[model samples]
Target: MDFDHIAEKKQEQKATVWLNLWSNRSPELLSMQLAKKHRPGETVSACLWKSGAFNICYRVRYKDGPDVILRFAALGRAILRREKVQNEVPEVFGSGICWAGPYIVMSFLEGMPLSQLLKDPSREGRPVLNPQISNRSLKRAYREMAMLILELSKHEFNSIGALEENKRGIFIARRPLTFNMNELMVSANLPEKQRDSVSSEEDCRKKFTARCLFLNITKELCAEHSQGPFRLYCDDFRPSNVLIDLSTSRVSGVIDWEFTYAAPAEFTYVAPWWLLLQSPEDWESDLNQFLIRYFPRLRTFLEVLCNYENKLIEQQLLSESQRLSPRMEHSMETGLFWVCLAARYSSMFDEIYWTFIDSQYYGTFTSLDDRIQLLDQEQQHEMNELVKLKTDQSTEGKESFTDHYPIDKLLEL
Candidate 1:
């Protein structure tokens, strides 16, 4: 896929943050002009908005027709077009882009975000209506969430890349796999000498090629046993992106369609981050307390997810396609999803890799000096490089906090 577009390119600052700040500090006159250009003969009834960390939103209503919401990506638009066909997301009203910022207008869909719906609404910015989500109320909500994922994962494409359209049609794998591999290589925590060697673009490109080959091989290992074909998926398939109807406890619509891609079935098969309504990296200071509650819920979630997959298989939904493989299945089992994410998000590499992920590939060993004696010479060579990386990390500093890896049998080969 278009590797150039993958988020590894270096920039001066957080472009999204800059854009957001600029939009806030600057006048809205230009934004209004943009809206006017897109929808001629319509009055700008209101400029309602909720500014997010990266994007700034505005609710613009037309006097004669339905209202639409305008959203801007401070970093700039990633993919060029709006995929209007995906019903789970808001309808794309139109877009108005300029040097200042990039913006798109979408039809205003009702219903509160699932996050607000599930939690206490008495708090500020909670959904106006609170749906009962006690231990009893969670099943319907969870099942609907699971079902949405199952249905959405059905749209498949031949290649592995970001979703984009061409003369042919709306294709999931149409875009090039454009993530910054250079950044990943830099994340290895190498000795200063080894790090200096990779200063040139050629070196980075070589590492990029190697990384891609590694990922391809890993993906194939999972693909051999998968039941479904590779398909388009939202990278951020969390609760915050989902809207739910309070009365029925059903998913009203799943928004945040940007950055969706046709990835390996293995990627989608992995458990989502929102399963516990918290992220591994940012759960809280009281991590142990959180996981005590989270693990049981996670087990039930996996049970429901797997059960749904089985039902799909029984009904022959996966007749021609592949199913979730053991490798992808181990995502939750090993928390390897975090590792997978680290490929592109290199900054998190040392923490995730050394803390937990390294054991999966290297087999059980005491330290960098310890040997498993199981891998072949070439595999051992790779392990040595990894060991050096780990050693460098240790030399730099120890992990600030410690906890057991959350799941079972993750350290085993």
Candidate 2:
């Protein structure tokens, strides 16, 4: 259930024309139901629009009434969760929870797309942020975004999971998340010859042991934070997810509430990836140049967050180390965000765990792989011994277990 496979499989199953609303081929039953919910007495006109991979959005217009957006579950309902605050999200008019998945029609909010506002056009179509976003009216957008993070942090949960509800009550999900990592390797459509290239059962166990130890700190940190006081967090919390009212520099809408979860509050304690508007490693511009451009806006965001941190401290919800007054002032200092990144996106175990975590600890590298220049004989010998010892100790393991992780250490974050 790694994030990539979920999307990949959905893409694979896109043979039905009606499944793709953006093709302007609307499904009749869906169109009628959506029209009935929001436009009871008029002819329905469903105009298709492209949206996230999980949904097919239709602008359901009436001959004589206001239009609404219909979000059909073109992929699956893995991302859907009932909202805690209805006003913070688009208003739902109709919903379907069926065997196929689910769909919802909701009131459409009008505003400029924040992506068009924040992004500078670049070659290859990837968004490079505009130079001026560091200042002027756009700074207000980042500040408001910082404030939104604080607003979301106001919620507290007893555990980490997707938030869900039923007639019984609201609860933390006992089921695995859509980003569950164990299923990633299992689901990959690797060639059989490549699969057969795996060394042996012992080698596989040893590699797993070494990787677990290498990732021990991150896994433990995640476990510790999962205990309580989790706040609402969206994995895709970039500016593109927002809609802005530029005249007043206010956030008019926070759309796409998918992937929202009650996650660790420490996920908010660090400076966010949103300021850069892209992952550091994959920025459209030169990484250094992107930072040079992104730093001022990042500073603005952290400063506003610091003000909220003080407020949280006064309210007894935050402590000194958790405050961001001074630490996040350099490139290497973004280790906390990388730690949070590593913990949350297990699909990125190699990229985050090996590279970002290592970079955070050992500083940047000329190359991140042992592919060309293999490890020295002495280093290889020591690593092999370490993995063998760890493998023996882990022989009685329950898959993905972390019962021994201490919860109190999370406060030190």
Candidate 3:
């Protein structure tokens, strides 16, 4: 079986394990957990709200008050709480570990996901823009989104890492947690740092090497400000996480800050890759076709973003020195947007690099071997072992799949 197929199956199995475990115990245990915050016999009902790759959300309703969202983290014990961006972000009510897992209780923003307004999920493959949505509505949506990004970029940290809270206070201590890092860890089945496993560490190193090398090159070539004053960036900040008021075409709230962290300022300079509701590397259509559909929307978004940038500057809410529009514009023009995208998404890195980034930066390569010399000897050996390990894992996964669901059982189904 293909490595991607096996990796995907492994992910599905993990999610199933989590869901089954949660379902079996959550009704009783979850009620007990929520009981701490609310009054007894308040008549609360909870139902699954949204399930992503690494977390699950439930909408908890009460007979007397407004609804709140309960999110269970499948990977880490972290939560996002920023008073500065409180208007746009969720306000955490409480968080703790229970029998099920680590969960966060927060205010539920009212409105549908922006993705619902922009595209039809009923479509089979890559989602296209909704024909019913007017250009004016899209522009209005972009304007609101522009303001949110600008506001988020206002907060800065000295170190590039995730914001975590301890007894002392909040600090940037942990390695920056991105969605790709979590996904890679899952796919590789890497264990906790306490576990003594050389292969696991090798797999982790393989993932980081690409990012480290890319950043070093980018710092020298494009992002001179990559070293300091890192800004908050949400890996999951897309239409799916953005809530919108349909009637007014306004952004109601931004949810899913779990994958956010203090990242290099260059990351915040790229125009959002979600403008088309489909990622460039994952687009099913030809590259030209995707770009044709993409550029127009990109232009619309940038125009609205520029207008917001000017408004914020004029109001003294933003300064000319802190203006993000020009940097973002330059990123797109210089192909730095694609570079940043490739560097960030591990699964999409190969496709994005070969298609748009590699040749432009490093010239054409006949094969990966041709470029392997760019890395140190130690890294080159590690990469070879990682590939062998991946191949073995794929084989083992295929055998395990067959053992669990044999050919006869599959035929019977």
Candidate 4:
């Protein structure tokens, strides 16, 4: 199929999945699933709540207390893995596969997504700060975010990975399940090709060739102190994943810890990418143009972050040695933020590295071929093979989304 056909099929697949999720939401089913947390037969009303890329959430309301959010993983797999990181995440009442779908029941938090408050439709074509948000509200929101970052940074773990409950119900270090990896495995239909997976040596080489380079380069460049005592890092900790009270300009709750893991301290030290409501790699404008708009908001955030750092120190909640604002400022100034962003998001790595990172370290090159010349023989061979494989995958038969999409109706699933 052509590009337009592929795009159309992908949209059809998305709509079908949504329809399945929507049709499955019966009051009886919702009540049955939620019975473990609340009293049964409370005359609950279920409504289509919200839909995200990976899950669909339903708002089930009863006469008393806050509404319950019943979420189903649309892809027929468990999205919520056990992770023990202390944050403002809501209490999970129950989670299991019910007739409606693979679900997780949690107490609904009352607040709009921070993304809604930060969005400025007018800013779509421009490189500028969000004009909708007032200076006062923006600063208040920044202060709360800085505090959240500071609080999370205090909790440190020895290993750089995710926390999972053992048979004894204790949280232990496990292989980190990063957001980028999840997207690759799910959206790209790529099989699990981690270092220890049973996948063939060739498959692992194709996946990890670029990844190894990123690790080596980051290790060579990143500060020695930022390497150890990994801190809790949530890849989805953007504005959309956070719930904020618009009236008070405060963060009420943080949700979607599916991508949370204990990662290098540099992940925490780099200023968040969501301040501008867009990823730099995905920015519509040129990198220089995006930075022109991004740096102003980044400056405001760093200022507020520094102030929070001082306050935490005064309260004895944070040590002077542990202050992270300076390191964050340095990350932006030295372009380490782009480095970290590229490290996590492989899809955007080529653009980000060629656009922002490569020039800073190895000086500007005219093309990717010139950059590849710098790599040794084995690395170059692996990169070439990986590139060819990805190119073939883009045009292949069943692996192509257009051929494999779920064009069937909701009931068919």
List, residue by residue over 48-111, the lDDT tens digit for candidate 2: 6546644667677767767777666543222222221221235577575432345677777777
Lowest summed lDDT across 10 adjacent residues in model 4 is found at: 79-88
Candidate 1 Cα misplacement greater than 4 A, ranges? 1-28, 75-90, 120-133, 172-229, 284-291, 306-345, 371-413
TM-scores of the models, in the given order? 0.65, 0.66, 0.77, 0.78
Q: Which of the predicted structures, 1 or 2, would earn the higher lDDT when compared with the native?
A: 2
Model 2: residues >4 Å from true position, as ranges?
A: 1-25, 37-44, 63-66, 76-90, 97-101, 122-126, 132-134, 165-170, 173-210, 219-226, 279-281, 284-296, 307-334, 359-413
RMSD to the true structure for each prediction, in A, is 10.6, 10.1, 7.4, 6.1
RMSD of 1: 10.6
Please, what are the lDDT tens digits per residue for candidate 1 over residues 277-296? Answer: 54444554454465576666
**What lDDT, from 0 to 1, does candidate 2 have?**
0.54
Model 4 lDDT, residue 73, Cα: 60
Best candidate (score: TM-score): 4
lDDT of each: 0.52, 0.54, 0.64, 0.64
Give the winner by lDDT: 1 or 3.
Answer: 3
lDDT ranking, best first: 3, 4, 2, 1
Compare the candidates by lDDT and give the number of the best one: 3
